[model samples]
Target: MKTKLFSALATMVAPTAMTVGSVSADAVAPQTSKADFSVVAKDPTNPTDPENGTLVLKSVPSFSFGTIEASEIYAGFTGKVAKTAGALEIADIRLGKSDWSLTADMAQFTDDANKLTGAILNLDSTGSLGETLTGAVKDDSPAVEVVKGNGKHGVDNFKMEAATLTLAANPAADLAKDESFTTTINWNLSSTTPTAPTA
Candidate 1:
C-alpha cells in the first residue's frame, strides 16, 4: 500500500514539471512613424460702417532759459560820458524751445512735425517788464520773439520772472487733436564787457 501511495505522488509531481517546461517566449517589434501638418489663414477686414471714437487732447507749454553765456560787469571809473551809479550789467543770451507733438497714428495714419510749432525765450533776474526775446531755427531764417511780463514774479531768491509764449493756431493747432502734448523751451544768455565806471 505504501509503494502505491508513493507512485501516485510521483505522477502528480511529473505533471507539474511538464507544465513548467511548456512556457512560451516571444519578441515585439518597435513602432516607428512621423506625423506632419500645415496652417493657412487671412486677417479679417474692418466693418464698412465704423464707429467714431472720441479723442481728448491736452498739453502744457513750458520753457527753460539757460545761464548768461557772455556777461560784462563794470566798476566805477572816470572816462565815461556820465557817471553811472553802482555796478553796470550787460548780458547777451540765446535760447530754444521744442514742441513735442505726440500723435496716436492708428490704422495707416500720420501726423507731420509742421503741424506743431512754438517758441521759447530765455529769462534772467534782470528781465524787465515788456522785454522781448527772440529765437530762430538753425535751418530756418524766420525768427520768433516772445514777450515777457504778465504781472508775474519769480518764486525764490533766483529772481527769475514769468513769461509767456504766444502760439498761433495755424502753426500749432493740429497738435491739439492728440490726447496730450508738451512744449520745452531752452535759452542762453551772454554779454560784452563794459567800460570801467568813473567816480
Candidate 2:
C-alpha cells in the first residue's frame, strides 16, 4: 500500500510533458492604401457626381462671357465666375497621402471656323478660405500653380468668391460672323504641393 501511494504521488508531481505554443497576428496584403485625384469637369459641373472616381475634382467655376465684337487692332473682354456660379471645388480622400495641388492651363480659343489667332486668356484666381491662389495660364507656359495644402488639409476645400478670365483677341483676324468662340481652361490636380508661384 505504501509503495502504491508513493508511485501515485510521484506521478502527480512529475511535470506533464510541457509543450509551449505561440500565438501571432499579421497584417493583410496590399499593406497601406492609396487614393486617386482628378480635376472636376467643367460641363455638368456636378460636385456629387457618382462618376467622379474616388470623389475627386468635385466641381469648378464656369465662365459665361457674353458677346464679343470683331476688331482690327485687337479687342479685350473679361468674364467673371463667382462662387454662386459653381465656385472652384475639389475633393480628396486618399490614404497614406495628403499633399496635393491644382493648376490651370487654357487651351487656344477655337470655333467652327478656325483658331483665334494671337488670342490669349489670362486667368486670375483666389481662394475663399484664405488660400493664396493668385495665378495665371499664359500660353500654356507650365500651368499656373493655383493652390496647395498651404496650412490647410488637402481635403479642405478652397472655394473662391470669384475668378476672372480676360480674353484678348487678335485684331482684324477675319472676324467670323455669329461664330461661337470657345476655349477650355484645363484644371490639373496633382499629388505634390508645388510652390505657389511668385506674383
Number of clashing pairs per prediction, in order:
16, 0
Q: Model 2, residue 28: what's the lDDT?
A: 9
Alpha-carbon local distance difference test for all models: 0.17, 0.36
**TM-score of predicted structure 1:** 0.21
Taking the tens digit of each residue's C-alpha lDDT, what string does model 1 give over 1-199?
Answer: 0000000000000000000001010111111111111111111111122112211011111122211011100111111111111111111111221111111100111123332222212222333323333232211123232222233222111122342222222312222112122221211111121111223
What TM-score against the true fold does each predicted structure earn?
A: 0.21, 0.56
Q: How many clashing pairs does model 1 include?
A: 16
lDDT of candidate 2 at residue 188, scale 0 to 100: 53
Candidate 1's displacement at residue 4, Å, is 99
lDDT of 2: 0.36
Alpha-carbon deviation at 72 in model 1, angstroms: 42
Q: Let me know the TM-score candidate 2 reaches against the reference structure.
A: 0.56
Q: Give one digit per residue, the lDDT tens place, for model 2 in 67-154.
A: 3334321464445232223455544444333455666555455444445433333445555445666665554355666676444434
